[model samples]
Target: MSQSTLVSTRIDKWLWAARFFKTRSLATNAVELGRVLQNEQRVKPAHAVKVGDILEIHHADQVWQVEALRILEVRGSASIAQTMYAETADSITKRQQRAEYRRLHTEPAAQLQQRPTKRQRRQLDNIAID
Candidate 1:
């Protein structure tokens, strides 16, 4: 297939090419799970993705709303992948805010490096019982 001349490609392929997912199968799975939406609507993996189409992708607790700029079937370098889509300004701001919030306030459970000791477990049980 002519990679540069193409006007459209599968949504899964586009996601992979844009580096949104590590592999095409993961992109397909995202689409199937409704984590990937085209123009704010859930789409199939095989849905045609054209230049200028808006896409919302959710993964790893992060969301991105981008406009497709290029249609590429083959995965390439990160720089090349980044050029395939342009993130919306609102999406950029929201992601940055989320990252800042995470940096400022870590999850309470994240401090636990290992499973609780017997004493801790007993205490937890006692607390639950009460």
Candidate 2:
């Protein structure tokens, strides 16, 4: 069914359909964990989400503030999912800035190619002892 025809859908279903979470259960879990807000208020997974309602979704290290443009119940193509919500300008800017910062600053653990060599381990132990 074309999602645009629906007046409203469950928040979890909408989140999954919009591709915010990988599955409906994940979306529900996120809602229960207080990672999602509807109109600035915490809502249950079954909460009804209508077109034009604002949503704040926090996933991983990024936060999204978007307005629902269509009510969807089924997951769809990425192109179709992108059509369902319109992110606010501030949200877009914040996400971009965060992405840039992450790009510029690498994760410390990411530098490790493998387990430490014996010499490296000994050096680490020596440093710890001192």
Candidate 3:
């Protein structure tokens, strides 16, 4: 069969080809959970995707807007994956901003351990009760 004549590929395969998810199953699950959006609309795992489609993928605390550049029937290597989809610059900036904010606002577990003991807790409770 010619390379271009491959039958319709699944959305999960497309997501994997586009490097949206590390595994095909992960992509499928994301689609199933409504975290995968096509043209700003949620799509199903079986959705047929082609080139030039914009996908908004919600991953962790950030959202990714990936523009499809090529279609692949099979999942390619990490190097080839880079050629399939292009991530919008805004998504990268947003993710970086979120990372920076989290780093700045989150307190370390070690510092959180400095909280009061039973005596302090009792004193505070008494104050609240009074």
lDDT of each: 0.93, 0.93, 0.81
lDDT of 1 by residue, 1-130 (tens): 5788998999999999889999899999999999999999998999999999999999998999999999999999999999999999999999999999999999756877899889988887898899
Evaluation by TM-score, superior candidate among 1 and 3? 1
Which residue pairs show collisions in model 1? none
The C-alpha local distance difference test score for the whole of candidate 1 amounts to 0.93
Which residue segments of model 1 deviate by more than 4 Å?
118-130
Q: Which residue ranges in model 2 land beyond 4 Å of their true spot?
A: 1-4, 118-130
Please write out the lDDT profile of model 3 over residues 1-130, one tens digit for every residue. Answer: 7546654467788888767678889999999999988888887899887778888888777788888777786777888878878889988898899899988898544354678789977876898899
| Residue 36 miss distance in model 2 (angstroms) | 0.7
Q: Write model 2 residue lDDT over 1-130, tens digit each, in one string.
A: 5645799999999999999999889999999999999999999999999989999999999999999998878888999999999999999999999999999999855776999889988887898899
Please list the residue runs of candidate 3 whose C-alpha ends up more than 4 Å from where it truly belongs after superposition: 4-8, 107-130
Q: Report the alpha-carbon TM-score of model 3 versus the true structure.
A: 0.73
RMSD (CA, Å), each prediction = 3.0, 3.0, 4.8
Please give each candidate's TM-score. Answer: 0.88, 0.84, 0.73
Q: How many residue pairs clash (N, CA or C atoms closer than 3 angstroms) in each of the candidate models, in the order given? A: 0, 0, 0
